[model samples]
Target chain A: MTSAPALVPRPLARARPLVEPALREAVDRLHPWLARIVGYSFGWCAADGSPSATPGGKGIRCALALLAAEAAGGAARDAVPAAVAVELVHGFSLVHDDIMDGDELRRSRPTVWKAYGTGPAVLAGDAMLTVAMATAARTGSRAALGELVGALDWLVRGQAEDLAFESRAFTGPDAVTVEEYLAMASGKTGALLGCAAAMGAALAGARGEAVTAYRDFGRHLGVAFQAIDDVLSVFGDPHRTGKPAGGDLTSGKKTLPVLEALAASTPASSRLARLLLERPLAEGQLTEAALLIDRAGGRRRTEAWAHIHHQRALHALHSAAPLPCPKADLTEVAAHLLHRTA
Target chain B: MTSAPALVPRPLARARPLVEPALREAVDRLHPWLARIVGYSFGWCAADGSPSATPGGKGIRCALALLAAEAAGGAARDAVPAAVAVELVHGFSLVHDDIMDGDELRRSRPTVWKAYGTGPAVLAGDAMLTVAMATAARTGSRAALGELVGALDWLVRGQAEDLAFESRAFTGPDAVTVEEYLAMASGKTGALLGCAAAMGAALAGARGEAVTAYRDFGRHLGVAFQAIDDVLSVFGDPHRTGKPAGGDLTSGKKTLPVLEALAASTPASSRLARLLLERPLAEGQLTEAALLIDRAGGRRRTEAWAHIHHQRALHALHSAAPLPCPKADLTEVAAHLLHRTA
Candidate 1:
């Protein structure tokens, strides 16, 4: 097949210039040392404080916030605080999640805990979260601030469950079920994105069903995005993603694909479950496990779930009845998020 | 001097019944595991999840919030959310502080990170903070939420500076100065107390100068409380405090007493500086350092500073011109805070 066009959403570039400066200013309120750590986390600088060539994560949440505000009949610039708050929260969660997961790398760079000590990394995460709240409060919008805090509550709860899953049995009643897995993903990956959209709408003076629609839109999109991530982590090219293939499998992460595969209960699925129960996968076993998972229809089932959620997200957006230009912008961004290789 | 009357303030009893229920409700929103860890930190339960008999801290900050509201012509019950928010923030800070300081013990029991793991403790702290913001937002007062967020920012900044001090030289240009130490204490301890008072008043609809007065009152009182705590940590009777005397000294904490003594630059202070530079303080070195600090007028200077701040706090309270009954209650609490033995 011919190569598809690139999936860069125009809204991201549009949002970056507005959100980046505000994000930096919020982080600047932290102590100089903490600011340095957070800056590194944002890919603004290297570990030693020099400017970095590597770019930060796509400001997808920021773009969503800006577009949501615009769609709700407010200027995108008016929602800059919402964009900054969500971005700070996103960075904070990543930093803490890395420490919790004991993952030492992100985007091919050392994780905050690996580069700085765990204690400093902990402080850095705390600083970012505090900055997020302070930035959100600056908007003088209680609804926006409430949305941010609610997302935080869900985020931490989700993280706690995700960690607990690591110790759970791979099979039987005590094992993590698919429903439990989806709930965890909704909190872990979805809540902040939901907040990003909801806060933007709220800041724009949108209330009632419209805000809910935007929240649902972002939440469903987040789940879809996470589902895609699970597939790419095991099956995509390492060169494209800048991460090792099957690393999640070797690390024993309870991704949607693996959970779905185990639920299938076919011969391959049974073997896959038993294989995962081993404390550490032996060399080349990761590839074998991936193959078994794929054979058991894990990849296809996961993709189907992604597609379902992706469609639900679009439906939510359509129900929101946003301004035409920003609605189209949001649709383009959502499609890109679903299709991105990295 | 003859023994003085006990320093228990009646406002604590009044505040507890109202604040505790709200605080528990907020904490209940966390994941079960996180709630358990946080419960242990709050002295509400043991490591094994059984209820604990040990009474928690006096909830001074909570009482402050309640009294501030009453003093500002609002019912104390009206500020329970503010009271609960400050208490949660206080507990959150302690959990994270224990991990950051690597202190294994608190109130003669294992710290949260010591009983649970560090990662869980980190999540517990985050849970409490999220609950705090949520609780504060439930007040539906933007000013109150803003105050709480501002205090969190200060709390984290102070903690970062306190950790940075551990690696700084004990003397010369690189040493932590008295001003820096006070500033850190203000952020670390004063900010939350200030927020408690300010938020209560704000929620009470007391604007402008009354809120500022309450904030300054609590801030000065908190600094004074910290000064006294620094002195007590070194010299207080272990039986009464339920902690080892001179633990702070052995830990090489850059508290007010030590900072004052070092600033004196006397021969004893110079000797104290050299003795501290040795890693893993030798046996009896703690008592020696305490004595050297005392001989250099550190103890007196610290006490004098505390007295000054205490007086300033009372003056600010008087300037606020709150209602007569609550003002009297606040004065009683302030006196207890300044003079408490433990």
Candidate 2:
């Protein structure tokens, strides 16, 4: 066993049809070629524009939005546009990130950039983003539009910072501090998820404080989710890749664990760094690197951080809506994220 | 002189201060790091972020917006936000285009991509686009938001097509048709300019027909502007770089001349294709390529097309607002573009 169960809460999984039609509609809004490329990127179509049955990400963001609206005592259906807008933005970012990160495959298929070539991928990403704005506008909420724009700005900033972390520091160190990594992660992932949750609350006509609470909850949840995912990439069950592990360690990503081990000020810290610095990480090296990270307390500390964020998210959600309890379902979501058995 | 005067018209020049402040404010809205890069892209800052006296491109898009407002019988001042939004979007596209094209210099200074690196440049472009949307939203018109989004969609589509033309088929045997080139030009340069002009009219509460007329006028003007710029780059006086006129020929851009020459059924067309097929055009080959292109009627036909669009723009403008005449100032603007001489 490597990590947590791959499960979304029942209600979140069931909420798909409520959000997906609108996603398809947003894709349809584009011109034919643009629509075809974007639809393929979203796993809605195969390489030749045929309908695809590929299961996409659990769409946790959409579920968060609908749940937020439901928790606010509003009809979740009314927030469909907001949900669709969130998905479009997410898709846009994924397409661009796949290109920028040189990711060749996604969701068991070739990435948009891999299949359509870089130029078309770029154009498709831009189109998705444009449609996202138009879709958001169609919701007829200027304030929500402003909120999403602000989140997107943070997203870009975070991406810039993330790329910068790849470079050596001006003082000659290439190591990323834990603090800097957290800030970057918050911007890159937390900001957009927080925006999604807040958008849902806003659509439900929740007051400012309630919306902010949802935003904060989503922000914490986003961090928690990323932390668990990073842990899984290092030690989780080999996601059907048929290999024991070839994830973050081989790529030299400075995830939470790596950063923690680097900051340990111990012999294992140097050992972990040495392993990480090797390209074409030798056979058995990824497993070795994981062991070193564990020895340096990187794995446990990261899990504890995830637990802390999960708790914070729950607390914030409680403040967002006290009357109706989503404690059980939301807990289920968190459990799926954190209960790893690696 | 082979073309129009090398000048900005009086009206366009006078509209500078009215538009400049808004541009500065838009820059100020960015995070400090982002602001510095974007401002440098706009030639408002030196490499070290200090203010620079470097002159930027003539604010033709801004002037069009103001002029469109004035033509629609509205005070130009009332359209400041619209103008600012246009400039922001324009800057966003320029930054991205520079990165994609690997352009190292603009306005006699290093491009953002060249100065700040690709990742930062991409982030700045994204930030500028977000700001453009927010700035457009400040105009308080959902209709204009829709208009801008529509134009942005076209912009992406055109860019995709333009990039596609760089392939062998489009530039070689399959040879991009004149119509295809026109459509690409319309999207690449015309859509945003047309959007800017129509945005100005729409901001002024112009009727639907009036706004549409302004949009058509701007689209025609954008195409005409691109056509003349293509011609100038091939034959007009060389820029301050002191390089002889080998700009487009050496790059093998599928410009009006190249496309026209390719479409021609003659020995010279074959000769032009052979020359273009060279891996790196020889030092003396660019001049020969230019002559072959001209002999194939590329230059004359392209100029005629520009003139036709120019007439259409004037016709559309006249239809947009008949009550108040902007005949002289608008003519000067047109002349400056169409009659450019070095």
Pick the DockQ winner: 1
User: Count of backbone clashes for each model?
Assistant: 0, 7
Model 1: lDDT to the true structure: 0.87
lDDT of 1 by residue, B134-180 (tens): 88877888888888988888889899999999988778989888899
TM-score of chain B of each: 0.96, 0.94
For model 2 the local lDDT of residue A172 reads: 22
Number of the predicted model whose TM-score against the real structure is largest = 1
Interface RMSD of each: 1.0, 2.3
Work out the TM-score per prediction: 0.97, 0.89
Please give the DockQ score of every candidate, comma-separated. 0.76, 0.46
B31, model 2: CA deviation in Å? 4.1
C-alpha lDDT score of every prediction, in listed order: 0.87, 0.77
Best by lDDT: 1
Q: How accurate locally is residue A86 in candidate 2, as Cα lDDT from 0 to 100? A: 80
In model 1, what lDDT does residue B266 have? 98
